[model samples]
Target: MTVDRSMIRVKAMLIAPNEDTSAHAVTLNVPTAENPEGYHRLIGGSVEFGETHREAVRREVHEELGAAVEDLELLATIENIFHIDEVLGHEIVFLYSGRLDPLPAEAGATLTESDGSVVPVVWRSVKDDADPLPLYPTGTQDWVSAALTRQRP
Candidate 1:
């Protein structure tokens, strides 16, 4: 039997907070033809062969943000099927929660992708109503909501 690598993808993402749990870091994807409103999602990248999701998330954080993550914990595992710019996509996403070292600026940070594309990273409110862009990979806000609720008395 042969495995088709292109059939599905596995990704490791982080909900990395700075000093406060009120906001988490996310990359802003500007508006496109298919998504005129644009969106925001956790910062992370693909999981490589022979690597665990934990390792991938850490490496991705270091590579993309130049920061280390602490207090890391698995938040959720979601299976997502969606279309981006009219192209179908499927992914098994591993989401993690953690704190970032050398906290990012309140205004935001910039991300340079491996492919040489630049994107902006901003701290978005954990509350769904307060966030300006929709967080993708589906199910992400659910974890944020649950975490926020636990943080409250």
Candidate 2:
């Protein structure tokens, strides 16, 4: 699995959990050959050229959820390498924990992606034992827990 330096993608994500820290908001990703059962992922997108990850997080959150990110704190940086539908992928993820200025409804709300596709932002349990669908970027479950608990590992 040799990866050229240029093939890796850089992105940022926010772990904006509810006040009680039991759950966090995520977007449902369509089922693929790699994850036939599908998965849930934190809200965010790629880090655009010339912008920092923090900027990207703010922009992504606002664009996707129509809300501002406040009290932002860097949680972790994860190197995610996987295959989606058999195509290899790699990414450098700058993860953060923050509060949404104008929070979305508890019942959930629809968000529009940069590609114009709309999806719902649903809150899911941070407890892996509780949720059926796995949260992505794989090994960051602990980071998610830190984000919800305001503790860094």
Candidate 3:
């Protein structure tokens, strides 16, 4: 039998720290007419054809966040498989840790998507248990925890 691999998507994501390194920057998914009950997610996007994971991460950040990142270090590669609206979805995720010069202010910044949706990029403490914001792509919390611990003195 022939195999169909069209369902698999490759995504590159970044874990970026705030200026003080106290928290990481994440996008608050604004609910649209199409998708209500929005969620939070890291800043990155799909890897385009002929693009390296690092290159994709940099390009995505510039497109989404309007900033350039440096010293990208691959932290994790996650095989994410789940169902969205009863449709099976799979993604090969490349997670990277990097530093952004002149990081955005504590008030955060706004990113406008191609579809004209405004997404807020904010810094949140990874260790905050009181905040009940839902972060996506399953296994991301564990990766953040480990990254933070590694940066500790």
Top TM-score prediction, candidate number = 2
TM-score of each: 0.89, 0.91, 0.82
Ranking by TM-score: 2, 1, 3
Question: Candidate 3 lDDT, tens digit per residue, 32-117?
Answer: 44346766788888899999999999998888777899878899898888655445668899998888765766785877765667
lDDT of each: 0.81, 0.85, 0.77
Clashes of each: 0, 0, 0
Candidate 3's displacement at residue 55, Å, is 0.4
Predicted candidate 2 versus true structure: per-residue lDDT over 1-153, tens digit per residue: 333444899989988878777888888878989778788888998999999999999999999999999899888899998887778889999988898878778875878998788887888888877988888888878888876776776
- Give candidate 2 misplaced runs (Cα > 4 Å): 1-6
- Cα RMSD of predicted structure 2: 3.5
Better of 1 and 3 by TM-score: 1
Off by over 4 Å in 1: 1-6, 148-153
TM-score of model 3 vs. true structure? 0.82
TM-score of 1: 0.89
Residues 1-153 of candidate 1 have per-residue lDDT tens digits of: 223444789999987765657888889998856568899878998899999999999998888878898888887788988777666778999988888886778885787777778889898887779866789878788787665455411
